[model samples]
Target: MLSLTRRIREEILVIDRQTGEQIVIAPTAYRGNQVKIGIEASDRFKILRRELQGRERGPGPG
Candidate 1:
């Protein structure tokens, strides 16, 4: 499983290790603390967060 951040609206997504499919979970902004996980076909899904990338965090302030 891969953890990726949604680009446009700050949503969360995951990819199934067995299947080569993408699951567009509920947006983190709206869900707040809720999370959803499931599997579905690619044709039945729409990607609100098109671009996804990762970045490292800087050192915390003292």
Candidate 2:
């Protein structure tokens, strides 16, 4: 895993070696304990928040 420290308006680029896909992640704003980020990627990519993953898909198999 790669970790980076970025300030507001700063960006990081992520590339996929297999498909040559690129993704850009930038911090737009920071308020108190919350931060807003912007992402640029192709439609082939799906972005999701960890907490919302299960909820969005509904109850999982029991």
Candidate 3:
């Protein structure tokens, strides 16, 4: 995983070398210990938080 420190309104660009896919991440707001980010990506991509992904998949193989 890549870690970065960005201030509000700051933007970062990520590119997938093989597929030439691009994603933009920008920090929108900060409140207390939480932060709001904006992500720009193509519709072909699927993005989800870890918890949400788990819920979507339900329980793992028993």
Candidate 4:
């Protein structure tokens, strides 16, 4: 994965539409377009780690 370059800070919150529960996530640029999908802490960490690892390893085998 290529570097994002820009350092954008934003918060992600998961809320139960029916139950009215709220979960606030750390500020990360990777939250783009998926903020409404209800991302958990573990999921966020996995995504961030994978993203960083991919950037370091470059593209996958074709």
Prediction 1 TM-score vs. true: 0.28
Residue 5 in model 4: shift from native, Å? 11
**Deviating ranges (above 4 Å) for candidate 3:** 57-62
The models' CA-based lDDT, in order, is 0.51, 0.89, 0.89, 0.49
lDDT of 3: 0.89
TM-score of each: 0.28, 0.76, 0.76, 0.29
Mark the regions of model 1 whose C-alpha exceeds 4 Å error after superposition. Answer: 1-8, 26-62
In model 1, the number of clashes is 0
Count of residue pairs whose backbone atoms collide, per candidate: 0, 0, 0, 0
- Model 3 lDDT tens row, 1-62: 88999998789988999998999999999999899999999998888886787565557798
lDDT of 4 by residue, 1-62 (tens): 33333333444565769966666554343454542323455332444544476566668899
* Model 2 misplaced stretches (Cα beyond 4 Å): 56-62
In model 3, how large is the Cα lDDT of residue 56? 50
**3 against 4, candidate with superior TM-score:** 3
Q: How close is candidate 4 to the true structure, as a TM-score?
A: 0.29
